[model samples]
Target chain A: MAHLGLRRFPPPLMVLLFLATAAGKEEYGGGSGGLRFRREGGTFKVLQVADMHFGDGRSTPCEDVLPAQQRGCSDLNTTAFLYRVLRAEDPDLVVFTGDNIYGADSSDAAKSMDAAIAPAIAMKLPWAAVLGNHDQEGTLSRESVMRHLVGMKNSLSGLNPEGIKIDGYGNYNLEVGGVEGTLLANKSVLNLYFLDSGDYSTVWWIPGYGWIKASQQAWFRQTSSDLQKRYTTEEPTQKEPAPGLVYFHIPVPEFGSFTASSFTGVKQEGISSPSINSGFFTTMLESGDVKAAFIGHDHINDFCGKLSGIQLCYDGGFGYHAYGKAGWSWRARVVSVQLEKAESGEWRGVKSIKTWKRLDDQHLTTIDSEVLWNRGSNEPQPI
Target chain B: MAHLGLRRFPPPLMVLLFLATAAGKEEYGGGSGGLRFRREGGTFKVLQVADMHFGDGRSTPCEDVLPAQQRGCSDLNTTAFLYRVLRAEDPDLVVFTGDNIYGADSSDAAKSMDAAIAPAIAMKLPWAAVLGNHDQEGTLSRESVMRHLVGMKNSLSGLNPEGIKIDGYGNYNLEVGGVEGTLLANKSVLNLYFLDSGDYSTVWWIPGYGWIKASQQAWFRQTSSDLQKRYTTEEPTQKEPAPGLVYFHIPVPEFGSFTASSFTGVKQEGISSPSINSGFFTTMLESGDVKAAFIGHDHINDFCGKLSGIQLCYDGGFGYHAYGKAGWSWRARVVSVQLEKAESGEWRGVKSIKTWKRLDDQHLTTIDSEVLWNRGSNEPQPI
Candidate 1:
């Protein structure tokens, strides 16, 4: 029963069970003020949540239903919880993993826009979103919903906005809080590779025209080499880029087909399926100083595993009833990372990582203070 | 029951049932080897099919049993039947909608590859494929598989052996039998825009990366105008670009999500969720002269419908069973198009199309050769 011969328990059933359990939990207790950050010495505390399928709450009993409803409800609650958490922690910055929307076409996709911009607009907290699958759907039309989410719109003359650059179809890079990250690029303080995967409309059976396309892969290789050159100096160079973080909506090495065998009656469901660009992810992890990979899609409780010396963390969905009832309800996790100072004063590596799960409660308690924290001798102390 | 809202049957079930019933029972015969040529003819036929989960005979089911099994079997048999049909029709060209392989990461993926490619190679025909959901499941490199199947590679070195001209990022254009098409170009004789839909690992819910970013969209618009100017002639011209055709894997005017809905104490399955770029297909359809679109995803049987004045056809699976037990088999289809001529011998429009289904003698036969020939007055007559 343990292995079940590659046919993991049907995904729909798992989703249902997760939902039933999640229903028993209370709504997020943290109010809009929860996501605030306080200066902790020389470093800042931040939260990272990806693939929140906002506006996906519909009681539909279809194969892909849980993700839909979960996305919608989660987005609203997540926003509310994020506000509360921000107020409580007052982190300096918030880093969103990806999958800001369930999809561009979701009836509730407008909610995603609200989720992404509302917090930053309301509290003036700096937040950045890496483009995910849901964010990339739809034509790049002025009237399309995705266009609005990414702030991509035509000017009065029907020309692209000045600051906006369409980097190779969907790849992009930007800086937040003086720290830079590039999706599919290596050279940055934090190299966040936001990959496209591929379109669902294309042939799923074939291996082209999707995420990790050749062009993107080539760009990634070049960027990695460039980062190595900049960051390998004995002295802390001003031009040197920082470590890297890869973010996407789907998990690499896909868990398995949710409905391949049960619904279709085909025998080779999980056994024959492919894994998401494992080689690419591995290469990046090995080649560059990739601190971590934040991802979503497998909406179970957090599972942190390593591949090729690279740490892979499945940051559970920010959407509906992801893990279980008692899990992080309407809440996302904030990770405060500080650089360690070696005896020589050069940035050695990650000095400390403190994670907080912001939950809703009438009064804040120490239990809700911090869920996970790791600090080294060279790490900065809390204020 | 007739007006059953989405609650009654989820999108997946609706699509599955539609495919099951729509897998027509007509038996297709072989092609008539008569060559017909018209210099000024501007008509050509194209076939579209999607989600051919080939090599599912030995597939292991995912958590969901019925749908997976059914989809697997249907996909495999349907693909086989499609091959037979394509060989019989011997059309001018063939277009693989998408999802040619069941799971690119599966152990049986190699077998699936063999099954899916056998017919295409045997026929010595030219075809193009887009990415699909099931295809993005595993570790099978998309670029490698695409290069093998399409006889083209994404070249970073800027030298293309397939004779296609590639951009710096491996994006390129190809001329299939004299008709120029770009893999991801703004313009071509027929602008074949191959989009990169996100992978299962990074937001499976969304369908595809919307249109080329804003900058690309501008280029697309300008390219459309330029192509029109370069190809269209107010007066009779000796030379002009061929009429346009758009190809990809997913369908447009997005369908509903692939989830489960509560139905009589049992949850019903839905179809795959729509992408944010659902509007892009509509926009492309609205582009004048974009006569038809070929896609593959719903792998039941061949059906053509019109949206926004554009004809859309799903070519059914190349390896799975179709619908009816009587019609169940694996196969592909070929489309032959003949451009209509004006009174002055100038190109006017597409004239006619004929579809052939592949079936064994054990199945029932219903296709009438004479009826097919009669449908198009411009049908090529044997010498």
Candidate 2:
């Protein structure tokens, strides 16, 4: 009798086989709002890689390193850089703040997204993303692009069962709660907001890039209100306000308002034109929950400032395919929220969160490190 | 058979007896954040009675409607006004923003608190409170006063297990999620923040009134952050920011920043002195979750305005004992949040929330009706 493909291996070998198959799988569950990472020593670390532009190297083999004249990247170098950043920071979460692939109508968004984030997926790093202006500029609509990128193995970027109800792609929220026994029970200390700032202006006469529409703003406000109400208790004596950060593709017009002199970091390129003062900045200000708004459109202009009490920031582009100034290296932004015992004698929530840039290289050197917000300070910044 | 002074009456009478005894028992559980009033077709109605100074009527009788010169109140009138408001609006939730009782060393805090909110409690109304400056100025410390009011029948005010860690009295958060087919099996939609803005400041330099301390500010920031992080899903795709409103005893310094002319409706008194700029307003602005701040310190001033993007509001004082201008009416703030289907096509949260003044008389007429934050408008207020 011929043996069927199914064979009864020893229990130990069977377990190893199951493990191997599971390891080969590429998609992870897009969690309910309750997904939590193991809180290491009370802190959850996040690394953000913006504007990967992976498709620029899609046609070239991994061994070929594109020269400066090519105005593109070496896929191998990009992957190596990601590996270095991951090993150096070992962040609990990784965020691709858009432009994971160059929008070539011929390029496959799914393939490019996979190639761009393959290292992270293999490492089983939890990750998320928002779309860049260039993402949907090709044959694929933003929704189609999102479909290709969402719900991959170990990936956290997809329209899910628990996402905010919105028309746009990649509009969602995530939470990181403290470890049990380390912090207050049922409390989430850090929140991350990923929004879709559209590619092209569809609203007629707005001009230039697409803006965050009123519908998206409404979704943000509504979802935000729900989260605050859920985690906070209305017990007559202890009111907690949740703090969060926002990530997106295009910068709000407020970014242009921050002068080079007002900033603390390197500014190798001029700030790109932003969406016409869409009330997104005002919405952020009004919600009173977002501490910093991070963006990726102005990849070469890696600088941040306190604009009306919100830190409007930019992370230098992570892909060589993206434009960069001479002497500037590919870099990523590393944001660390301090989870500690607050003044009220509870190891419950974060009081201070800081951000810095990590050079996407072998050394993984950091620069422009600064406190984003300090709970003890009276002023929004240290002044 | 000596009945031990208790006799078994008819079955119905026995049931009544049990209920009567049960009514007097204290320590109702502060909700675990899932408590929601039946959303009357997608509306969460709240009746907020500000500054109800219900004393024991010890110095005077219930009939004495303390003349303008007198600084105390009539217990009977206060109860009657509450009854009238409740009968007219039939609100889902009642909030005694502050000064529910006039603290008198001779007056029992528990009795006064009960008497003031008795009508709502007897009606089985879900109610909450924040202590006013006068709430602790008498025989009882604020802590002692809180102990009396903490656990009462059908009460939503107490040092709850779900509360943020803080050193103050009456600082908690509440949520009202949409009932999924009449049961709360899903997430919360609306969040209400109840904060204790402290009595007199022990911070020697700041004389006169107390202020929101760094500790409380820190707590607010931390808790707000925690809430946002908890409800927002980080699955690489959907990041929802939570929106919320805040309630407290004294107003922050930012209240004074709004000019008398910029306000609408009633300003019977100069905006009462607010806490010295202790950066609470700055904190709210920085956190980006709180849309409006409701306050009750100034019994005579009942106006709200957009000051630096956050609404600083006051609900006209409710107590007859509290100082009111001649011809000024006793009123409460009626806040309602719209629990409609969001753009995301789900009733997962609230988009627009509005607040208006509800007269405490039988008429229950609304004045100062305004859109606190509309879902469709570009501006927070009606343009």
Best model per lDDT: 2
Which stretch of 10 consecutive residues in model 2 chain B shows the poorest summed lDDT?
Answer: B1-10
lDDT per model, in order? 0.40, 0.65
**Clash number for each model:** 187, 53
Give a tens-digit lDDT track for model 2, residues B1-383: 11011112444654454354355632222113335535455667888888877777445333223255245445666677788888777787888887777785326777777778889988887777778888875567888777666677666675522322334776667765454442122334455777777777553323456655444555565556655654464211125444667888887756665666887656666655432444566456555566788889888888887864567888888877666664566778888777656565545455677888877544677798887775444322211
- In order, the TM-score of chain B in each prediction is 0.56, 0.81
- Candidate 1's displacement at residue A376, Å, is 20
For candidate 2, the per-residue lDDT at B220 reads 63
Model 2 iRMS = 13.0
In terms of TM-score, the best-performing candidate is 2
TM-score of each: 0.39, 0.46
Q: Output the worst ten-in-a-row residue range by lDDT, candidate 2 chain A.
A: A1-10
- Stretches of candidate 1 off by over 4 Å are A1-383, B1-43, B56-83, B103-115, B131-140, B152-229, B233-243, B256-270, B274-279, B282-289, B301-303, B321-336, B346-383
